[model samples]
Target: MSGFDPRPLLGKALDQMGELITTTDDSQRDLPTPCADYTVSQLIDHIQAVVRRIGAVLSGQPFWSVPQSIESTDWPADWAEGRAATDAVLADDAILTREVQVPWGQSDGAAAAASYIGELAVHAWDLAAATGRSERLDPELAAAALPAYRAKVPAEPRGGDIPFGPVVEIGDDAGPYEKVVAWTGRDPQFAA
Candidate 1:
């Protein structure tokens, strides 16, 4: 499915996170994650920033002409609001396949959608782990995300300054959730 459109996956990722964030207890906000330096709050904020940018691009607005760092505040709520914004963008026909310049480079609607979906799935696992939640990416969503993630990584041979070891080797018997987490650089077995 090289020609796969990423909108459905993007929607699914948003739905998954929206459900979890709504239900997560406020007390679990301080847990750690496999995303190295990020705490639960920071991860949530990062997801929000990325989603917001995607929404802007999809709406034919400028993306980050003046990118400012955000302080971590009201993160869970930020995620919910950002998810709504991203959902709005995905539903907007004007931006989805329209040629737009992204922060990384120039891309069409399909590439942008795929990148956004793949990013959301990765961070959802980060949030799930930090919150001690059982949420997982849909199998089809995870499968759709792999190629996009791989494309984002540089092709330099392993053991460079990039810490990513390899294309995570997951078993055929592995569940979809595990595969997704592992592929995204999260240790599937991490516990808060």
Candidate 2:
């Protein structure tokens, strides 16, 4: 991720995830998602939390101080605030050069931003699949995030803190987006 400005792509990924959050109605909150551990509401909350968490990291705050989940009915508004946090902090390119210590270990800001792009991309599909809005998914974001996912998460030894299941095999017809989630231990054919 060196020399690459992740702000633009990260912004796009966030916007894509935010739209999924905004469109998720309360009625669907109880529905299960591809992430077996999280309901639709839980997943949305995680998404918002991660955005805020990123902001905390960018501003040199303890990212773990941010809660891992929230229960919200007004996600669009919450999403705006979370987005604004990152927007304000990341506006200056200088922040990207800073050596920030994140929970995953110390690295420059760009690596941190690049790391979450793949995560958000997978969750975007999770939201879509859970909400019956898979049609709206942006495949390009998943495609962009694939290399990052591959570089970090391995294809085996999943469980516990790994947060991924064994990769579910996809057919040759599966698109780039499906492959991205699959690499993170997701089943491309997740039915819930």
Candidate 3:
């Protein structure tokens, strides 16, 4: 596994997501995102849930026991709290060397963190696209996540057991954020 510390990339991706969450108005909650089944509100809750899971694994808690669904009464606050806690856990250098039980199985912390970063980045793009703020997402963050997606997330045709759907086709000239989104099974041209 790559020994590169994913904290910086993860932080950037989470920060991008935080920005998206902060700007989301209540009227846009029902909008459809590129995640296929999730509406804007549901996607926000899912992001919070995933962040909580990351924190649990990092803290040596039983990650599998964490609830997969988080309520969305006050998403910004909930996301902020989860982000702070997860960020604290990720800040530890030793986490990169330890093994963590991820949804796919056990993996070294570096790989696990990288996978989360990729997941968050792609979802941030989805939110951006749904909310008509796609231009606001950071291309640098998506570029950084591509290597992790390539190394950790399989490119094979997606099945029921896989978290992502089949990868969508994109042009060779597609930008970094578009490539990242398409790699995660979203069409870059997705419109709400």
The candidates, ranked best first by TM-score, are 2, 3, 1
Model 1 lDDT at residue 114: 74
How big is the positional error of residue 172 in model 2, measured in Å on the Cα after superposition? Answer: 3.0
By lDDT, the better pick of 1 and 2 is 2
If scored against the real structure, what TM-score would every candidate get? Answer: 0.79, 0.94, 0.92
Candidate 2 lDDT tens digits, 10-117: 888898888888878899999999999899989988888888888878777776878887566689998998899889988978768787767667878888877778
Q: After superposition, how far is residue 62 of candidate 2 from its true place, in Å?
A: 2.9
C-alpha lDDT (0 to 100) for residue 26 of candidate 3: 91
TM-score of predicted model 3?
Answer: 0.92
Candidate whose TM-score is highest: 2
Model 2 misplaced stretches (Cα beyond 4 Å): none
Cα lDDT of candidate 2 equals: 0.84
**What's the distance in Å from true for residue 18, model 2?**
1.4
